[model samples]
Target: MPSKLSEEISPFYVMEVLERAKEIEASGGSVIHFEVGMPDFSTPAVICEAAVRAIREGDTRYTHSLGILELREAISEDYENTYGVKVSPGNVIVTMGSSPALFLSMLALLDPGDEIIITDPHYACYPQLIKIAGGVPRTVRVYEEEGYQIDAGRLRKAITKRTKAVLINSPGNPTGTLLGPDVIRDVASLGVPVISDEIYHGLVYGGEAKTILEFTENAIAVNGFSKLYSMPGWRLGYLIVPEEFVRPLQKLQQNLFISPNPFVQRAGVAAIKHGKREALGMVGEFDRRRRAMLEGLRELGFVLGTEPLGAFYVFVNASGISPDSHALAFDILENAHVAVTPGIDFGQGGEGYLRFSYAASVSDIEEGMSRLGKYLDERKNKSR
Candidate 1:
């Protein structure tokens, strides 16, 4: 029999959407992709040049399990400059990606059957990571009407003696909603460790997304270079753990992944020092696409729970069109040739919604929206 662990995990529905979109394109169809969460932009030339230079200079070797000191120090300095928190380099653990940082955090802290709390309609992987770490995921249901913000009172009630951590993602995945300082404090007050995923930090449009370190020293902050630098394929991310977790996480890092790529780490250093300007420019473009997509989606009669203040996604209401977002997603893909993620993939609370990513170019966003609108309009006409 296949391992039970393998059986327990569900597919990342976004990938399925992408694959089906590709199949259509291969069969002589035009597809406008809005399914995946990655930015359509190339990795900044400066960052890529740095990685290439490192490769050409033969800088390929394993870095320290805790990562190169230069990169760690850069991350430490960023916490001070960006979030006003003074983090020591000794506490920073570089991992292959923020996903690993989160997994390591859960593995390092959780005992078998320990529970981690998160908000529903969350990033698809949050609960899976918790379970993979041998912990139970205790989810608090947050609604689209409230911008999918966590209800701290519910979080408080959900906590049992077995709860080990409270995981939060802002400028969040799928929903694109940000949690404010007040909500962070309420979560921290529960006296459980918090894992803050700040991967989409620099992607905010109007307001800012805060690191957990800003509210308390008792949390783990995970941030990375992917979304900011448009460098998802580079696979470089870091974790800022409390002083107490420094060594244990480092040890876990030593075992699971000896170190992330050296060339990538070098590129990461460049991303921090010289790539911010490039990233900011990309963010400007993303903001433009975001606005265009939001306007287009609303015009098509989808209800947005709140304006997305950060990230490049708009999770809109689809219950008016169909209750099964999963089936509806495929129908849109096959008929309209515009791929989008089903809300059911995000969790139960997300079942009646559809998450559209504006990480594509502005033109692509406009075209995808047009196709989707046409498809819906045709469906209405047929029903009438």
Candidate 2:
């Protein structure tokens, strides 16, 4: 029999929405996708060229389980440059992506029945990953009015003897709200290990996102090239662990993933060292799309409780129209041909919300919002 863990993992609903969108497109219908967080931009040209050069130079082979020394050094330098933290190259472990970096952190941190505190309406994979690692997830509800930022006090109250760590995402998914520095400082003082997901670090618009390393050494920082460098398909990410955790994480990486692709590691080095100009350009474009999305959603009567100045998403209250976000999301896809993610996919706190990703082109975003306006209007008239 399959283990209960395998049976109990919830479906990632956004992937379902994406699949249905594909079906629609295969049938010759148009789909304006707001369902996935994937960037519409291509990987930076310099990064791509570096990868190609590595491939041609026959650099494709297994690397150090912890990653190539060059990539690790590059990652270490970045922490110093960006966050003013001196991260040693010896503490870095590269992985296939940030997903594996997070999973490995869970495995290394948790014994069976150990607990991790997370925010409600968090990234969809958080609870599932904890469960897979044989840990329990305790959620603290974060409100839309508070910009979906986790309250450190509530998080403190949630901790018990079994509490192993606290997982946080800045410029978070589904909401795109950056946690303030005060919140980060307070959370760091809570006397627990922090698993900080900094995947969207360079994607912030208003103010900078702070790395947990700046406040505490008790952190496993998970980051990758996917969001900022537009290299999702490249499958490259790394973790910054304390010196003590390095060997154990290295062992886990050796047994599980062996090492990330050698050439991809080279590409990651190039991205960190040389691709910032291209990345900044993409961020500028995303900011423009963000403004357009906010205006369009407001015009359509959706309630945005807080400004989403980071990442590429706007999580809005859709309960005034329909309480079931899952059903409503599908209805929009089927009727309006605009694909979006349901809030319930994040957690129960998200049930009556809808997350719109502005990763699509501004033109597509405008058209999708217009289609939604028409769909809602036509539904109201028919009911009358």
Candidate 3:
């Protein structure tokens, strides 16, 4: 039995860091985690109640391949209400998660050997997903000085005849930098399809994230209930595709997944329609933790690329302490009992950096910072 070439993809390194942290915890040692991107909070009461009601009502059967009509309509209305963008229910494809949404989109749009351009320091899974869909991922390096935004000129330069789409993540993972509308418009002007991952849209701290729909009609908007609604385990997400691509994407979804879980789709409807206030409340909590982590890292002499404006992560330059961020992350886990993600997991431009997620509580972040401070102090003393 042989595995497919795509099955030989590289590991998602953040998971490796998490496994190491778990091992340390199993040995009866405490580890303050800043590595994982998941929220420490539980699902909102409204979402949970909805799920329970659906289960009690015996709504566990399979649904339409695209999703339950109600959930898809709610998702479409969400775009209209929140972003003032008109999306028809017919254009929405409910997915198992944004992961499968990405897979479906790439599969529906790209042919083998087709190329997709993405920023260098991107969410680690983007390239792997492209490979599995039989497409090639072309990365354009983004500099930290520009706050890790993809330069429009560099993106245009990277576009070759085989380029099928440009993938972008706003309130980007690891860096947490949000791209402005100008950049969004520039990329859309290239006439290539754009795939915007807006899973972190509502969780932004400084300002709202821009929807690619605001810039171009030729883009796919992927969003989920996980980050914004604190419902990761629900495994419910949606993608708003261009009208032209909707039916083909639906055909692919029907064969690949049949439909999202029926009860989960009902829960998703409640999440989008009635869970707004509860979801907004979580954003406030994440904002506070974001500030605390930023201040703590600065106090410890780490140079960050920018103050994170949206997502709950702070990407810091770790080259001053060590060039090998992966080794440093492991060292910190062992010595200080704190776990952080190595930037190398993101891409080449992120090699000398480390991503700290603020999804944990303030107290946990404070304790992690204290451990980091003590470790740095001891290192300085030894140097003398």
Candidate 4:
């Protein structure tokens, strides 16, 4: 039998929706995909070219376990430029992606039974990551009426003696809500170390997303090239830690991942220094789709308490249609052929909601909304 730890890890439910969508495609049906968080944009050419150049130059050998210095330095410069946070290159550690960066941080920070607090309706994998790191996750429920923003007061109330950290994601997945600097300040005041997931940083559509580092040095900021740079398959991500934690985290990285791909690290340097133009263009297109999605969902009678201002998703309340989001999601897949993530995949707070990703093309978003509207109309007529 697998160890109890392995058994304890829950499956990421959105993958189930995606797999079914794939099966439908394989069976000669078209599916409009909004269930995944990945950007559909092609990687910027300069970043891609950098990797090819590195490969041709024979730069594929194992690199420093902390990643190549150029990439780390580039990341440090980005913090200064993007967030006004002066980070040292020594404090950045690159890994295969933000997932491993967050996981490694948890592994280093968590002792057995230590508690980490996360917002309810969070990314589905957070609790599992906590569990895998030998920690327990304490969930603080943030309501949709509040735009699902984490309440620092409630978060403070949830912290206990065992609480070691508070995990936060801005331009959050499944919601695309941006947490402002005020909220980051409030959370920082709670006296718990913060794990800030800023992977969706550059994808904001409206208000600016703040880094926890802007308020506290006693935090970990996890970011990567996947979302903004459209380099998901490149598998490069990094974390900014307090100066004191650098060596230990470096040792952990050495043992666990050795390093992220050396060639990919070369591409990462190019991505930081030169990929902004392509990334901004993609963000503009995402904003276009986001607006269309919000208008369409509202028109279709899905309740959206507030307009999402970041990332590429709009979390819709689907309780009026069906309380069972999982079943409803699959039903939409089978009948409407439009794939979306069930809110229950997020957490109990998300039970009756569905997260619609606007990462698809604008035309695809329009077609998806039309299909959903037709499906709902037919269902309504049948009920009548």
Instruction: Score every model by TM-score.
Output: 0.98, 0.99, 0.98, 0.98
Worst 10 residues of 2 by lDDT: 144-153
Model 3 lDDT per residue over 1-384, tens place: 557774689899889989999999999999999998887788887888888899999998879888989998898888998889998999999999998998899998899999999898889999899998999999999888888778888899999999999999998987898888888889889999999999989878776688999889999999998888888877888899988888898889888888799888888988888898988888899999988998999899887766788878888898888899899888888899899999999988789888899999999999999999999998789778
- Considering only N, C-alpha and C atoms within 3 Å, which residue pairs clash in candidate 3? none
Question: After superposition, which runs of candidate 4 have C-alpha atoms over 4 Å from their true positions?
Answer: none
Query: Residue 116's C-alpha lDDT in candidate 1?
Result: 90
Give the range where candidate 3 is weakest over 10 consecutive residues by summed lDDT: 1-10
Model 1, 1-384: lDDT tens digits are 988998979889999999989989998999988888988889988899999999999989998999999999999998789888899999998888888988999998899999998888889988888888899998899887776778888888998999888989989988889887788888878788999999999899988888888888889999888898898888889999988898899889888888889999999989998988989999999889989998898888877769998888889889889999999999999999999999999999899788899988888888888898899989999999
For each candidate, the alpha-carbon lDDT, in order, equals 0.89, 0.93, 0.89, 0.91
- Which model scores highest in lDDT? 2
Worst 10 residues of 4 by lDDT: 144-153
Write candidate 4's Cα lDDT for 1-384 as tens digits. 999988867888899999999999999999999998899989999999999999999998999999999999999999999888899999999999999999999998999999999998899999999998889999999887887778887898999999999999998987888886788899998889999999999998778989898899889999999999999998989999998888989889888888789999999999999999999999999888888888888888887787888888889988888899999999999999999999999999899999999889888988999999999998889889
